[model samples]
Every structure is written in structure tokens, then in C-alpha cells.
Target: MTTTTYPVRVDGALDDRLNRWLWLVKWVLVIPHLVVLAFLWIAFAVLSFAAFFAILFTGRYPRSIFDFNVGVLRWTWRVQFYAYGALGTDRYPPFTLYDVPSYPAHLEVEYPRHLSRGLVLVKSWLLAIPHYIVLAFFLGGGTWFATQNWEWSVGLVGLLVLIAAVVLLFTGRYPQPVFDLVLGMDRWALRVAAYAGLMVDQYPPFRLDLGGDDPATTRLERRTPQSLPSASPREPTPRMSAGRIVTLLLGITASLASIVGLAVGGGLAWLDLGMRDSAGYVTTDKVTLRTSGYALASEEVTIHDDGATLLRRLFGDARVRVLADDGLPVFVGIANGADVRAYLAGVAYSTVTSPGPYSTTYDDHAGGAPSTPPTELAIWRTQAVGPGEQTITWPIESGDWTLVVMAPDATAQVAVQADFGATAAALTGVWIAVLAGSGGFLLIGMLAVVLAVVRRPEPGPSTLEPASAGRSNESEDIH
Candidate 1:
């Protein structure tokens, strides 16, 4: 066999005493791991963003960041191996980010001391497109079968795992061929993940090395004391403390929130600047108001007593424009809720319960029509009457208010198309402040996280050599 190896190695050894029915409940058992993984993946995204810049300018991934990222991948692989990815083992995965040697599943990525500065720009997105497409089938793509009446969807790896689980359930053994195929697919996905994550500069070869052991596992070691006279094992990478992990995660979450706030703030600024008319009024689409009664009235809208000056600064001028559908003289007015009720008392009218694009509903009040025309009423604070299109502009104030639209002659039937507008002068400044504040927070949070992740810990001592004298140079480097 051709011995080709990639930097990312994923291995999973099958358990000798496999539980037959445990696979069925593995989904329920893996819930805690999945919950923790969700947060870890978010932190992974934040760290990868920082790593991109570091790799771009320095041609190197920070050693501390590299180790932490590898730990995340290792943790994920162990969980996947124990659960659905291969169901190769029944041993539970540890909660820590560091690897456990006794665990059946392991992932190791050889750290690159120097990466290609130019390749870092395109490898993750533009160069990795082909593998992403291939993985779409292996991970998730389409339904297994579909008909007019029913459909069932499953990915290739999932189907294989299900088959193996069923076989193990009845025959007391997992199919080795299926396990090998699953391992190959999982390894392929992990390699792509590493490359696209900017952890490696080498392109992942489009070859499947099927089996539990990696193809690079060929070198045999002579571990006898006489055979290894000159060297000791390489020092293990320091593990990130749980407290540091928690702090990093909090920073990442804050940065994500800042980005979302910036986006929303930018959108509001766009609307405020680009959508207003010459009079500084942003208007809504015309809504048709119709009623088979003397008038159509809006629901009681309460304006809190926060002072008229503050209200004016917030809402600006409130304007309502009405156009009679039947080309009749119409009257539209805004009055206090109590005044409106006194005027419309014992008068047949509909209070618009809800207005929507497709349907409008009303709460009907049963009585006779008004005795006088709406234009002659003294209750209206602001009114427009006798027109094809009548407009009313009123300063916003603190009170319970209602809008009433009716025929000027108090006729039973009324139909009109109306639109509302407001000169919300405060929005432009509000959005600008939001953009500046969130932008600052985003930068600060990112800087804090990067600093924390890249901080180098103090080296304790050298464990790679024995405490004896006269060590010979004939031993091979264990790397």
C-alpha cells in the first residue's frame, strides 16, 4: 500500500466488550457533551478569526492557540467516536479539553512552525470549496428515499452507523468493514476541518485511508533501556486551565453580541437617512379602512406623561393623511379617548381591533347613527374635513388618544385609504451612537481574548533528558 500521511490524524479503536443495546441510547447519553460542545464551538470561531490575522502577518499560528484548538478537535473526536460517528467504543469521553491516552479515540495535529503567509488567505474559504462539497454528502445532503406519500432522509455515514448498530444488536459484533468506512469518512472530515481552520498549510489529499490506525503509524520503536540510551519522551503541551477557558468563552460571546448590535444599528441608520421624505417624515403604506357604520375608530392609544418636549423630540410631528375612496367629503380627527367615547356613545361604529395585509377585524358597538355631522363636532383636538384627500398634523403629547375617520355628513357607510407618518428626528443620532459604542466593545473584547489565548506559560523544567551525565548523541529524535 502507498504510505501517504496527512498532518491531521484521527484514530478510533473498537471496544473488545461492546454493549449490544447501548448504541440505541447513546443519543440520550451524549446530551451533556453536546451542550458543552455548542459553547466551545462558538469560542473556536472567535479564536479562528484571531488566528487568521496572526497567520497572515507573522506566518505562524500562536503555539498556545494551536494547542487549545487541537484540544477542542481531540475532545470532539472522542465524543463522536463514542457515540454516533463510529460507535467504535463504549467508554465515556472525559470533560476536560486535554487528551486522555487510555481513551480509544484520539486526534493529533502536528503543529507547523511556519505556515505560508500567502496560502492562509485563500485556503480556508476559496481553496476548501471542493472538500466542503464532498462532505455535504458524507455529513448531510438529501433524503434516502422519497415518494408521494412519505420520505426518509439519512446521510451516508449515518446509514452505515445504523446498519452497524443493528448488526451489533442481533449478532453481538460490529461489522469491521462498516467501522473502517466510518473511520475513513470521519478522518476525511477532520482533515478538512484542520486545513480550513488555518491550522495547516498543506492541502488535504483527496484520498481515503480506511482503518482504525492512521497510515502514518508505521515506525516501530525500540523501547528497551539499552536501545534508547540517549533520550526521553518529548514534553507534553501544557493544558489550558478550566478558568481560562471560561474567561475566553465569555469574551467570545460578548464579541458576538457586539457584532450583532453593530449590524442592527447600521440597518437603522440606513433607514433613517435614506427613507425619509423632504419634510423629514417616514411614512407607512396606505391601509384601507372600511366600516358599514357611522365611523371607523382606532384602538385607544395611551401616551405616557413624560412631558410634551420629550415626546416631541422622540416622536416629532405625527401626521395622518386620508383619501376618500368614494370621492365624498370625509373628516378625520384625533381626540382624547374619553371625549371620543362621549361623542360616539350610542352611535353605530366599529373599533378596528386589528389591521392586517389580508384581513381586518373590528369590534362592533350596536346603536343608531350620530345625530350630527363629524365636521360640526367640537370634541376633536385636530380635524380635517370636506376634502378628496385631507391631512392632519399634530404635535405628540401625553394623553389617551384615538383616531376617528367618518363621512362629514355622518352617513352610515365609510371607506377610505389612509397612511401614517412621523418625523422621528432622534433615530439618526441614536443609531450613530450605537454603532460607535458597539464597534468599540467589539475591538476591546477581541483584543482581550487574543491576549489571553496567546499568553505563554512559564516552562517548569526539561523532561526530555535523563538526570544522568554523558548522554550520547546517537539516539533518534522521538518527534
Candidate 2:
């Protein structure tokens, strides 16, 4: 029987000269790297999603996306090694995504020439569930116990790292055995990350290979009959220029924004299609309004056109419906703001400043009852009066207008259930354009990101030479 080494290689060369107190401040120092890594991780996820489809159809991961993803992993490993994962290095991690050989931490993944079309579908999620469960303990962040009225949660790795930090703080020495164990756990996590990220087809082994140097790179050569000596270290992978990094980040940000836009546009389109009545009106849920005043009036509203003809095309007639709570003949009317105010002047009424079932507010006026009945007033541009329900329809024109609701008999204590509706005939087209435009920008963003992060092919003896050049030498192992 034979065994193969894992393709993911995580290395931490503990710094010879250590800073005792630096580990404490490394958390604050790594803030910039953490911030950058946050965005990079988001981009990594987006690119990985793209890779999943590529592998499914082409049976191979896209090389450009692969390099970018590997770079992100490399960047993360260095930060972990410096800050908390192992505290193996004192050197500040570089901001770039490329590997830094002098930085005491390294990570590399072998580019797979072929991938299982079927495996790509489940490897990142379903197949990785067991590893995820184990990782939940190793790197679970922590557990929360809420019923006890207090919280207690800490991951095994975090606990180990804290102990290591305390020991180093007191003795000025990082315990070698603790370092080895932490390294092993970190290695296991990286391998699982690679596998679950859909970067490899091989399932991660349950075994933990503990040490600063990977056991696969060293001990396997001496112990296994089929193993070969480790190859000479290769040159560092080319670093993405600062400009390219900026471009990639911007692209990812744009793509994320575009996704939000798509969601909003889709929601709008869905509502436009699903909520409209036969008359092309979208109505709000009716709410009850009660006031011990002679009339119920809406706050004066002013609509401006600004000569934007699109507004006129986008909106149609507005409708207001009022149903009397006590079966009294109700009057609902739309009129100029001044006219309604003048008609209701010297009369006790309530101005509905805000209207909702739970958050309704009003400006109450103290005066005598109306001098004349609302049904006899000619101020209303459009009015409806009936026993059970009254609905008024007014063309949505640009002007100061107000809606007045009252009993036709000029009595106080007006109580009615009211609803507002609008014929937004152009909404469907507007949302459709939004969806289409967002999709277009999403493509542009993805393209920009790919171009920014993808390793460009260099002139070499063979086209495959570039792939080999970029391949991590640490990945070499007996199959």
C-alpha cells in the first residue's frame, strides 16, 4: 500500500529573533492586512463561484482564477502565522497577495491539470461537511451558551495560541512543541480550506502532520519507499502590481454593488407584476384613521415636475379610498392645498402628518365645527360621497394638493379605513432596464477583476512552461 502527499503546502519558518511583546500588538498591526484580506476573501468567493462552473463544464479550473485564489490563501497564511495562528514570525506581513519568501511564512497550491467535473459540485460543501465539523472545533471561532445568562466560547486553536502567547510572554521563548502542534492544526485547516475551496479533488486526510516544516516535504522521503527527494526551491511567483490590486478590489466592489442592484431590481419587477390590479394600480394595505375632529386632512404635499418629462410618463392617476367606520355617508376629496386649508379654517380638524396602522401622527386643530357641510363645498377638484365607501381619483399633476376626508353631514369624530393607490404604468420597464444594466456592469466587473489578478503568460520554451513556472515547487511529491 502507498500514500500520497497533500498538494496544499503551508510552511512557517519561525523567526530566530523574536519580539516578546510584538505578538500583543501584532493584532493592531495586522489591521490593514485584515481589512485588505476581507475584500480579497470576498473576491476569492466570487472567483471560486466562477471556477466552479468552469470546472463543471471544462473539467479544469481556470488558471487565472486559480492563481488569484492561491495568492489569497498565501496572504492569509502569512497573516495568521504572524498574528495568532502560530505567532511563528515577528516580521509584518506584506499587503500584497503574492508570497513573500523573506517573510517567514509561505503557502502554495499545485495547479491541477484536470478536475473531476462531478467532484467540483459537492467537494466545497456536501463532501466537506465532515471536515467542516472537525474544523468547527479546531477553528470554530467559539460556541455560545445563552441559557446560562452568560457567554463562554473559544476555539481549540485559539486556546492553544493564547497559551503559547502567555508562555512566550513569561519565558521569552515560544515552546517548540506548542509551535509544532499549532503549525499542524494550521496546516490541516489550510488543506481543508484548499479542498473545500474546490482547489483540489483529493479529500483532506484526517491526520495532522505537526511541525513548522511540513512532514510531507521532509520525513516522507526517508520513510516511504516510493517517495522522492524534495526538489530545489523555485523562484517566487510574480506579484500583482499595486495598480492591478486596486483595480481588482474596485472591480470586486462594483460586482458586489451590481449584485445588490440586481436583487433590488428583481424585487421591483416582481412586485410590479404580482401586486398590480386589473386597472394597473398598486395599492397599499388599508389602515384605520380615527379623530374626534370635523375632518381628516392630509398634510399639504407639493409635487415638482422640474421639466423631467420622464416623471410624467412614469406616473398616472392617483386614487384614494375611504370607507366610513360607522356606515355614515363619507366625503373623500382632492383639492388645492390652500383651498382645503381655507375650507377647514375656523373648523376643528386633524391633519394626518404621517399615516400608518401603528405609527400614525396628526396635527390637531382646536376650534368649532365646520361652518358648511363638506359635500356642499365646491373646492374639491374630485370628490366622492357615499354611505359605505367613497373613492376619489385625481390625475397626478405637479402642484400643491391635499386629500380631505370627512362626513358629508359636517359632524365631528371622523373615523374611516383609508388606502392609497397609484397607476405607475412605467415601473415595469424601469425595473427591467435596471436588471439588464446591472447584469451588464456585473460582466464588466468580473472581466476587470480577472484581468487584474490573472497571471499573464510569459514568453517561455513551452506554453505549459508558464504553468510550471507558477507551480509551487513544494507541491512535488510521490503519487
Candidate 3:
């Protein structure tokens, strides 16, 4: 047996070079770290949920979780740079799995970008598809499941599974690199986001844990530089990353929620107006009522609240029992049998007083032209009446008398409105169901994408040539 002991150097290396960025990173993250992390994590989480559901519904998008994480990371870094004054300033972007200068004798491994740009963009923008599908199934499905008398449990489970499968499958076509990077961020951030997004799904939490990644493991010992560039390239330019993806999704979701909120609020306001304007009609007789629409009987209506009634009157039936005309009930318009029936149903027609229809033999006054005797014929057509210009003409003789009545027309209009509510609900339900079904099929197509890159794995930088960053492109091309 042999024992070898080396002299211990107890003094810490105070002269060791420090990464200037270390201080910035430490202080920058101390207080605001959680806030940024929370916002970014929530964003990506929502995106993941939406994207997964979208793939399920539409049968489109990349499916690899690693690639998805990468995309999110890239996006988040760019957003951070811009927000933190790094972009358009002299600071590097944050959380970039790419562009993270490799530490000396260290590795910068990343999951590959297997998806195409066209497909990736399409998937990114259409994340709304899943959101809508999820919303529909949640609200509409719940309603249907509750109201219907069918045993929908088994079918529901099958349907939901199908949807999940489709989403996973469809996403396989575009194994986005940006999304992969997001998952590669600090484990804590990734863990929190995962918890929010995959709570109900088969998707698991981050493969790596937070605060577990060591900076020293990836730090590099760069050769002394001749000079640092006076004006550094604009940092945090928009780049693909998992974090960025989350940001985009969050922005979209927030916008969508705002629009929906406005619409619902406006609708509630309208309902309130209708309730406020409600009134019970009071009619005296069967007058030829003219209005915008129909008239309903009280039995057909259910007044939930009280409202005001509008009374519009023309120069007719209103009473004038004052001075000069001595108690005359000014009946100034046409009359009919219904009016008389309402006024005095059983009274004898012959017993009705002075206002009687008279018929006489031909009078030979002024060469056989029959007299222009007063009759109820001309009063059949309703006379026009406006406010002032809206008038009523009496075709009856100067002393002729006719009866009139007051009627209201509000109840009938509500009957026409009754069908609108049920119709809208049915239509909305149908569309939502269709969206959910589509999401399921979409998920089926995403599985292939997941398989493609999930197996590809992240590679070490040992085999990689350093990026054309510090060196000139012309020098490499010439070589």
C-alpha cells in the first residue's frame, strides 16, 4: 500500500480574475429575479398549455419538449435584454443557451432545431387555437355534461385522451429549438413554469432542478483580449428561446382576455338596459295600435324587474272637461264596432243616442245629384299624425261624433327577443365542440415531432467550432 499527500494551499486565490458580469448577474437577480422569473415562467407555461392543446386540435407544430424549451429560452433572453436596457445597450442577453460564451474546457450543449421556420411561425401565432379549444371544452363541455341525461363519462375520457394524443403528435413536426432553451434556464424557473402548465396532463416537471446548475461548470478562461470594442453590438436582439416563447404566449393570452372581458361587460350593460326599460302595458280598448313591432299579452311574459313606461299621445281621446267647451269628452277621431263593444258591450245599438247613421231617398235638389251625406266610409283609412306636422283630419260632418280608445304595445316585442338567447347559446356550443375535436386530431400528429428530436439529445461543445463572434468572417472564408 502507498500513500501520497500533496501540500495544501489554504490561502484562497483573491488575485483570481472575476467575470465582470458576475456582479451584474448577482445584483440584477437579487430582488427583481423572482419577478422576472415569475412573469417569464407564467408566459411560457401558458404557451406550453396552449401550444400542446393547439397541436392536439390542429395537428400542426413541433413536438419535442427539448426543442420547445430552447425556443422559449431564446425569446425570453431577448425580451430581458430589451426590458433591462441590455438591448440597444452594452449588455449581453440573458438565459440564452446559445450565445452563452463557453467556459474554458467546458461544454455548451443544446437540443437541436429540427423544425422549419415556416412551421414554427405558424405554430407560434396559432397558439390561440388551443386556448379557444380548451376554453370551449371547459365551459361548453361542462355545461353539456351537466345538462344532458347521457352517460358521457367514458366518451369524455376517450375524447380528452384523443385530444391529448393529437396535440402531442402534431407538435412533432416542428421540434422548435427556442422552446428547448427555455427549459434549460435555471431549474427553479423551469420547475415553477412546468407546475403551472402540465398540472393535468401527462407532461412532467423539468428534467433538471433549479439552483443546481453550477456557473463554474460552464465558465471559460478566455485569452487576454487586445481591446474591448468601444460600442458593443446591440445586445438582446430578438432571438429564439423558451423564455421568449412564453412571453409571446402570455402577451397574446392577456390581449385575448381583455377583448373577451370588454365584450362580456358590454353585453351585461345591454341586458341591464333592457331590464331598465321594461314596462307592463295598460290598454283601454282595441284601438288600431301603430308601433315598431308586435304586442304581447301579459300571460306570455315574465317581468323580472321594474322599469319606466313611455306614453305617446296624439290630439285624440284625451279628455278636456274645463271651461269654454263645458265638459266635452273630445272624441276627435274615427270609431269602429270593436271600440263600441269595449265601451258598451251589451247596450242596445238602437238605444245609443243622437249619433245615428241616417239613410234617405234620393233628393231632387240641384238636378238629381245625390246629396253628400255623412258616413263612416272615409274614416276607415287612418289619418296621418306627426308632432305638430303629424296631424289628424276628421272627414265626418261638422256636428258628427265618433268614439276612440287607448292601447299599448310592449309585451309583444319581448316574444320576438325570447328566441335570441337560446339560439346564440346553441351556436356557440356547436363551434366549441368542433374546436375541441379538432384539437384532439391535431395532437395525434405532433407525436412524430417529439420523437425526432427527443432522441437526438444535446451535444457537448468539445466537437463544436467556436462561433464566428470575435474573429472576422473574411478570415475564415479565405482559409
**lDDT by residue for model 1 over 1-479, one digit each (tens)?**
12554667778898877999999899999999998787677667778887889999999887767766776788899899999888999988988666566788877776676999899889988999999888887877654444444444567889899999999999999999999999999999999999998998879878777899876422212222333544234644345576676767677777877888899899878778776778888776688889888999999988887777787896699999999998988999999999899989999999998876556889989899898887887889899997799999999988999999999889988899988888988988889988998898788777756665654443211112221211453354422
Segments in model 2 whose C-alpha atoms lie over 4 Å from true places: 1-4, 13-28, 84-88, 133-188, 206-237, 285-300, 305-310, 322-383, 387-389, 399-419, 458-479
lDDT of 2 by residue, 112-174 (tens): 889999998789779989888888788755445655455445768888989988988888888
TM-score of 1: 0.75
lDDT comparing candidate 1 with the true structure:
0.79
The deviation in Å at residue 335 for candidate 2 is: 5.3
Clashes of each: 0, 0, 76
Q: Please, what's the RMSD in Å of model 3?
A: 23.6
Winning model by TM-score: 1
In candidate 1, where is summed lDDT lowest over 10 consecutive residues? 461-470
What are the models' TM-scores? 0.75, 0.72, 0.24
In model 3, where do residues sit more than 4 Å from their true spots? 1-49, 55-70, 73-91, 94-186, 199-277, 280-479
What is candidate 3's lDDT per residue for 367-468, written digit by digit as tens? Answer: 121122112224322322111212233322222233321111111111111001111112233334444544443343233223322323222111122233
Task: State the weakest 10-residue window (summed lDDT) of model 2.
Answer: 219-228
